[model samples]
Target: MAGESEYTYVVDFDGTITANDLSLELAAYYGGTGYREIENKYRRREIPIKEWLRQMVALLPPDLDQLNRKALEWVSIRAGFNDFLDQVREQKSTVVVASDGFGFYIEPILKAYGLLEKIEFVYRNETVTDSDGQLKVINPHAHKICPVCGNCKAAHVVRIKETGKSVIYTGDGSNDRFGASWSDQICARDRLAEVCDEYELSYSPWEDFYDIIKIEKPDLKDCSDISLCLPQGQGIKDGI
Candidate 1:
């Protein structure tokens, strides 16, 4: 039974865990006028995500500190995530976050919410400032043959699945399609749900972590916590 329950959860950070897309939000304000066109292109599938990201990042101001500050100020996470993490930790489940965005802002934001240490690994583009103060993106997990994503979430899932643990993937974007397809179980929301529908892939749809807990892992639903669970009718809030 112990071996049967061993699960590794690969979650998406931006939209799945958070209520809003942090990078897109930041890019809207800081990415200048050129960001929108690239975003549109990506949305239309005229440009691949990797190139779209490159064009988007090129429009930013190269101030990592300011970018971090804006994210801390504007970004928020989905409700009940801490409790979800609590349950995962209690079960000793491995949790990994795969993002199509940058980690420069993700680290600080998670630290602020006290969730940094709970996450085993974060797979995303490494954002660094050059000597001239220009931002550079380094993708260590990119697939040589795949041109879509800067970091291949599917590849990570495949590797984790090789270890004989069930891989449960949670995400809410078009980019999540590949990874979610390879997972043993999928919890999808928003756009990813539509993708699942289009492909006829089985998935659990959720509004927030509360839905995820109530629907997928009911055993952990009654688990106790103050900030993690809310009274009936108060409704769940978004983000950390």
Candidate 2:
């Protein structure tokens, strides 16, 4: 029942939209020597992203303004991202940004590049200072039952799909596999591509957003078999 032009591009922030992973960079800059240990744990899959955020936040200073300032200075938008946004707007398609990182600087970074308004939605977690004056990560968009991602990108993909819009997921991290698995098409790079390969999922490798613009908008397919989560049914994968 959806129009031919009804398509949603579910994009990842951090390394996907920006040239570097701001979250990782920030954590490394402020988290100091201990940052490497936490990061290694995450890379080894010993801890999910939600747990990573909790542990990482503990190392960051409680001054959000200082963190935001650093993020603005270090943020760099990926090549062709602005053009891709223009093309999507011209085609009447939607762009939704999904990030499972620290997430406080996403808006500031996008607005700095004058691309915030181009996106239809941003699904991300919040970094807040608790009553005890410590920085903490709050996952308002997380899956209630799944402890994997701080912000459940898979749920965002399924929500758009249920509205009859075809979704094209784009990302560059290992955590992106969950959302990419639910998408009609996957545009992956870096760790995301590696994970897709590991899972035997079909995906297009991309270096920049220009490559994304050239990717054919895919027709909606039955993704139940390949998806890690059944949004309408039993929720996340059995062991995940």
Candidate 3:
């Protein structure tokens, strides 16, 4: 079968892949006082997410090895995720991880799960040491006005849609908001589920990914059949 003819899935790394956002968890573990300050600023809208990320990274020591070690030690792949991924593979669906978070943890976590090579693509912040010996946050796209805390998931939606492939998205936080808004189907939990209800978007709360492997619902549910379906004109491309 042609690979492009197969389905494509874009997953959010933090809460979607694991149980929580590794970047947020990383901040609590590494950023110290500077992290709290940035969080408050973001909550208050005192700074745009782009600038906040710029500032947040400025506070971290340029310790790539240390960060990688910590991520390997504490980060976890969500329950049932590996099996769900395998099911996707069995069906010839491509899986991509698009994250606003840094790549330091993502690469290692996927490696730990033996999924690093299988993932189709990864979009995230790069790592570099700054003049002050702090890790610098590098945004290749230098985005502006992200919908979530510090990055724009919407942009990823646009990129994925450009391929004109059928896409499925799974996530937990509002970071997946605009992206979920564009998916052919979406599975979410907690805040994102609430967002779906409020916006009347197509979505369902996922307990874990075991159902994805064993059940037929997620892969078969059509957004158009639901009352909460987004308008025909929203999302990454022509909104279809």
Candidate 4:
């Protein structure tokens, strides 16, 4: 079995870590009621995800600052996430947050929790305010062929695997399908779990980061001697 340091975790933000999906929340709150209709079309496969993302962005107001503030105020991470990061740090493992959502809010949310430096890298869409004060998305990591997720999580996972470290992916969204396929191990829940089921990919179902730590570091499950894991009975809320 591979030890903790032998793995590189490529994780998803939004629904995976946060108690809710920030992008969808932003769209529903700021993008208007029609946002759900557009999302439904994408979910139903009536329209491509690229177009769905574009339409969602179009619904947001021009104030990037306001959006960032709203995200900071509303964003809540999974319980025991801090403990998981501590373990990753102790093992010196690489953990990357790869998401299709814009980074404008992600950066701030991570910073707020003092977990910004704990992440090895972040791959996501860049957001900027144009001269006309409108929100614009800059996708540097998008694959021209894939056209679904603005940022290609699978590409990053493949690159990490080339470094000789096993990749472990954790996610809870449809956008994670390709990346989950590329990972050596998958820690899935909610929507991503359903996707894994359809493809018959073996995965470890998780309710939160605690479940992940248990599977990834079983020896540390009862490591109360170390402050690496949360105290038992201190349960965390999971929206899913």
lDDT of each: 0.76, 0.91, 0.66, 0.76
Top candidate when judged by TM-score against the true structure: 2
TM-score (C-alpha, index-matched) for candidate 2: 0.96
| Candidate 2 stretches greater than 4 Å from native | 1-3
Q: What is the lDDT of candidate 2?
A: 0.91
Worst 10 residues of 1 by lDDT: 220-229
lDDT of 4 at 201: 72
Give the lowest summed-lDDT range of ten residues in model 3: 227-236
Q: Estimate each model's TM-score.
A: 0.86, 0.96, 0.78, 0.86
Candidate 4 per-residue C-alpha lDDT over 13-127 given as tens digits, one digit per residue, 9 for 90 to 100: 9998798899889989976678989988988867755677778888898888889999998998998788888888888887899988766788789989999899988888888
* Tens digit of per-residue lDDT, candidate 3, span 32-140: 9989988888666477555666776665557888878877887767898877777777787778887767666788778877988777788777778768676877776
Ranking by TM-score, best first?
A: 2, 4, 1, 3
lDDT, candidate 1, 85-158, per-residue tens: 88788878878999988767887888899998999998989878778877877888887655667888877876
Stretches of candidate 1 off by over 4 Å are 1-5, 215-240
* lDDT tens per residue, model 2, 104-189: 99999899889999999999999999999999999999877776888888888988988888999999999999999999999999
Of the two candidates 1 and 4, the one with more favorable TM-score, higher being better, is 4
